[model samples]
Target: MDRSSGGRDRILRPVIRQFDLKDLPAIVEIDREVGGGYSPELFMTFHEYHPQTMLVAEAAGGVVGIVIGFKHTPLEGRIFWLAVKPAHQGRGIGRSLLSAILRIFSRLGAVSATLEVRIGNRRAQSLYASMGFVVDNVIPSYYSDGEAALIMRKIL
Candidate 1:
């Protein structure tokens, strides 16, 4: 998606595509930069079991964003993680990745999609809300750091 604000200064259009094994390093780096702290092994596991739901956003010839999700049950999909390189954030890459994953989930026959967001992350909450996800519940001490999480869901 092209996130340029106006004419005469076009931004690089991000191309959303399936995750490639070669994108592992870049994806890990983006997650680290975004303070996600997710292990590379987690991504590899998702790739192994749910390759269709793992996607990356490429811009300027580099991987700038990624989303990992899966249809955990016949009627539900779960979004495990999403991150955009700090330098590439606020330009729609994260949103594009999210939209792509949600579409994949719908195509995979999910009736609903769900995700968890840190309570303190209002930005993420807002984005998810804008994408039709509503807060379904809250999990106390959900994170290793003792932070609570908001469970959000959307009907696919």
Candidate 2:
């Protein structure tokens, strides 16, 4: 897939795998770059609670994408966070992460999956919509910056 690490020219392919402690820093960095700004504690909590559900995409021996999700019940799941390195965006990393998480939810017998995206993030909203996630509700002031969020859900 032409994944190059540190300017080296080599054919690289990333595998979607479970998150590891070493991937934490990369996850935080990607979140900041994407303006997610979620606290480290939250990420740690997600990892500690459902380590298997958290996934990362590694190519050229570096973490480039991540998905943090939690299974709320046998029938419900929530995608808490997803981010891909800015340089890796538009390369299907985000889609891959989402698909991986959804696959896990299905295997775990989750009937539905839910998430919230900023109201103005048309790109993300479009991606979610394309994945069959319909807007289920609106959350006023859902973000710390007072940006409303659109709650989207997909029946898995």
Candidate 3:
């Protein structure tokens, strides 16, 4: 899908691509801006071990969103993190990043995908549901601040 917006005279479209080491700084900044709290080392680890599933959304020549996922088993893919720059939210960037990763997972032979979303994040839950994910379980105190998490799953 064409993930673009703005007036016709000045169209802005986000290009989804595989993550690179050079994108670390921008992605870290985005994670911070969105209060994702993930360490840079974690991003590097994902890039090192699962480059195909680690992707970034670039628009206006800068990274604006990121999705980190990996195949947990031959049949299962796990989405570890997803964050979009606050300034770029609601522009279809997050959805693009997610769809890209899920496609990668399926191509890698995964039969199902799963992710954990903070129970209070209704916006994310809504997006996941729209993409065919259903709540499969819930874990109490899943976050560092004591928030619970809903484990959502979707069949590939």
Candidate 4:
């Protein structure tokens, strides 16, 4: 959480900032880079339609990751997108992003945090599981590429 570092960048402050509509283009591209292939229209629509629940992560330079979710119901939150630049992966950026978003959800009185991950995305699955999310269901061919999605949930 050390945002002001002028040294080796060994200590990341792990910023959790509110995602702006302006960031959608980059986010959509990040999706594609991360193998999530989100359409531009869908990205714009989702962010514009749900600004209250979007979050982005940045470092000393600029935004390198994003995590989007929405209130599924008054008591539940659904994470739609989470992508970190490949160069930044395995550096705790994604985890900090999730932690930040989950805190916001908890403040909104959300009782659970849920998301669907493409079945083959073992890295993401492990991340979610580490965050206390458990697989509760599966939807066949849920992804555009026909990848099955595991519906995971964390009871907050």
Q: Which one is best on lDDT?
A: 1
Model 3 vs. true fold: TM: 0.91
Show pairs that collide, candidate 2. Answer: none
Name the 10 consecutive residues with the lowest summed lDDT in model 4: 1-10
Taken over the whole model, the C-alpha lDDT of each candidate is 0.90, 0.85, 0.89, 0.82
Q: For all candidates, what are the clash counts?
A: 0, 0, 0, 1
True-vs-predicted CA distance for residue 59, candidate 1, Å:
0.5
The TM-scores, one per candidate, come to: 0.92, 0.87, 0.91, 0.85
- For 31-148, candidate 2 gives per-residue lDDT tens digits of 8988887888888888899987899998756898889898888798899888878776656667888989999999998999999899999888877998999999999999888999
Model 2: how far residue 2 lies from native, Å = 18
Instruction: Give the lDDT ranking, best first.
Output: 1, 3, 2, 4
lDDT of 4: 0.82
* TM-score, structure 1 vs. true: 0.92
Candidate 2 to truth, TM: 0.87
Give lDDT: candidate 2, residue 5.
41
Candidate 1 residue lDDT tens string, 16-113: 99999999999999988988988989999999999999999999889999999988899999999999888876767778999999998988899999
The deviation in Å at residue 31 for candidate 2 is 1.6
Residue-wise lDDT of candidate 3 within 1-156, one digit each (tens)? 233655453334789999999999999999889888889998999999999999999997799899999999999999999988887777777888888999999999999999999999998998899999999999999988999999999999
> Against the hidden true structure, what lDDT does model 1 obtain?
0.90
* TM-score sort, best first: 1, 3, 2, 4
